[model samples]
Target: MMRQFTNQQDLVHAGISYYTTCCLNLKSLYDNRIELKTMFISKEWEDNMWSKNEAGRRFYNLVVSNEFWDGVLYAINSFEPVVDVLRRMGCGRSSMGNIYGELANVKREIAFRFENKEEHYLPVWYHIDCIKDEHMKTPLHLAGYYLNPLFYYQNGNEIEKTEIFRDALLECAHKMYPDQSVQERIVHQLKLYRTASQSFGRARATLMNFDPVSWWELHGSTAKELSTMALRILRLTCGSLAYEQSWIEMVHKKKPSLVQCNKFEESTFVMVNRRIQEKAQMKDRSCTCIPSQ
Candidate 1:
């Protein structure tokens, strides 16, 4: 029946998002919503044997319900920000420097999308906050955000006055370079960076480079120690697995028994491994069978 409106083969299939395909499924269903409603109400459906049955009538009721469609719309809007963050992390590259900023942006995006309605965005924010508070917001992440030239240069001296940034830098400095002398030197270099002095003040440094680690490499020679710190912090992984695991744990909290938790973990593991194997097999086949010139 659905194929009559649009070929099922042409609709979105399972390879769009990482691990879970819920977002892709939601997107596909939402895209075909009008077609679905029209099909349910068409004379063809009325003449069908199943349409007169109790189960079919109930299914039809759901398809035409305003409340059901409203809920789907709300889910799409709420889930999109989280999915975007996941997509950014899954880009097969280092995203340590951007995760903190990205999470902040997620909250802001959700709020803005719902026109600042607390009731609408609060539940989503609460779950995100739980993940962030427990796994993210470490001194390392904060240091990365502070050192990344992408964010640092935008806020300018304003970040210098921010206690959280100052504290995070100090914490990372002490942790990474325990020696008092080295810590003092890092602090001194931080001042130079803040004031845009030395190598940091070079005309070349003023150019807008989006890669934070690369920016430090190119323009941070004068403060070699701070540059090294930036490279280490910025090169770290944002841990896409951590986000996925945290979400799973959050769901487990709402359910009962270790059996359910184990089942969920097993299913997720199988799904991800299957996809990985499929990609690997495809790569091998392509390598073995060269295209004709």
Candidate 2:
């Protein structure tokens, strides 16, 4: 029946059971709405015994319903941006530098999709805000947001002036540094960073197009203490999938050890370093291949 209405014999399948796949499936169904409605009313459907059954009738009703289509459209519009965030979190590249900014922007993107109508967008915003408060209200998130070169330089001095960011930075600094003298040095170096001193004040530094971790490597040396903190924060991955993958790979190659765990720890560190080196090499190749305008 579907084949009579459309060139393809079946609905599009995303092939996986993830939430993102569900969204994709819904989008596909919506894209095939015309084909589906035609299939429901065609003689082939009426003559088919299965289509006469109560279950088949219910499915046919759903396919032709205006309310159902409206809901599907709304769900796609709302959840698409969220799927984008999930993809970034799952990708091999470090999302830590941008995840914080992405989360903040996702809310705006959803609202804009709905034309900023409060009646259409406020409920979605409430749920997104709840998720942010419950799971993402961490010092690490704030520190990453503040350290990202794109965000940091774009917001000017306002990032440092923000109270929540200020508190999060202080918390992260003290927690990571431990020593009071080191904390003081970090604070002092932060001022130099804010004022755009030395290498940080360079014309290229002001461009705000560079990768946060790479920018730190190039210009952050002048602010040694703050640079150390920025590099550590910006290099983090947003999800635990990579860690779990590393553990699975480790177990496949080596026997479990309860007594000699230091050896396992060393192996994990080596694997992590190898992954970082591989990503860096890929980034360098990608950069070299881009033609200069």
Candidate 3:
């Protein structure tokens, strides 16, 4: 409602002032964007290789748009300028501009500063509150507590993110720590102290947002090319499927000592073929692999 003022120049002036305040920290949105753009360009992030800074520039424009500046101008003329400026944004309680700035601000805060172990993990703990599913959340919790990069292990370059995931999960288990012998046993064997120790010095744990569980593990493996062993053993975990000894079975039975995933992705073709065969036979379109001319 505050945008109707003809003399909104004062609001713009005041807004310019507020944005410049940057928490008394050494960052301003304008300055940070420029620096980050330089960094991204130097690293040649995939997004940047394709018109990178243009998007960031547009965001800067939004924050400093004339309409926005005018609203800010008008706001300064009033006693409660913050309220008026918010109204002009017309976003009710949810301003995209606010979110954009907040995310940018946070990214700047934790971007490269993981030097202090406890301090580094403080931000991630806030993010973990956002997770809701246990079947998956369990792995994530383990990884966070493990605090090590979920990507690297003692394994060779042939490593997959799963082993890292297992280690994190093992670490998380110790942290939550049910009093049961089973929980204690798993934690003891996983070497939690050692893993968390390594993570303190490396940047890997921070990179994956400290979670080893990824969407790749979420969807059952797609069959393409993998070892014959993978083809024989990949098992899909039905989300609704619940069991008592499930973890034990998965870890001891289906888990190939050296293989790296839920295994179903590597070996799901036979099941798909069987279903296709059944459906085709139901119709006259039964299976046929005739070469096309």
Top-scoring candidate (lDDT)? 2
- Between candidates 1 and 3, name the one with more favorable lDDT: 1
Write down the lDDT that model 1 would get.
Answer: 0.73
C-alpha lDDT values of all predictions:
0.73, 0.74, 0.33
Q: Which stretches of candidate 3 lie over 4 Å from their true place?
A: 1-179, 196-211, 214-293
Q: Tens-digit lDDT track for model 2 on 1-293? A: 67678776566554112554676678778888988999898888999997989999999999999999999989987887776675445444445778777877888898898999989888988988897777777999988888786777778577767788878888999999999999999988877777777787783444556678888888887788898899998898785243236444665466654526677677667876765565455444432321221
Looking at model 1, residue 1 earns an lDDT score of: 72
TM-scores, one per candidate: 0.76, 0.76, 0.19
Across 1-293, the per-residue lDDT of candidate 3 in tens digits comes to 11222222212221211222222112222223334444434444434533357885575455545575444333222212222222222212222112222222333344333334555435553553342233333444324322222323322133234475455454444444554565655545334333433322343335455222221132113211111111121221121112123433554456567545655544444544543354334322111111111
Clashes of 3: 13
lDDT of 1 by residue, 11-91 (tens): 444532343356656766777888889989999899998899999999899989989988987887788777766654554
Instruction: Provide the global lDDT of candidate 2 against the true structure.
Output: 0.74
lDDT of 3 at 1: 12
By lDDT, the better pick of 2 and 3 is: 2
Model 1 RMSD in Å is 7.3
> Cα deviation in Å at residue 188, candidate 1?
0.9
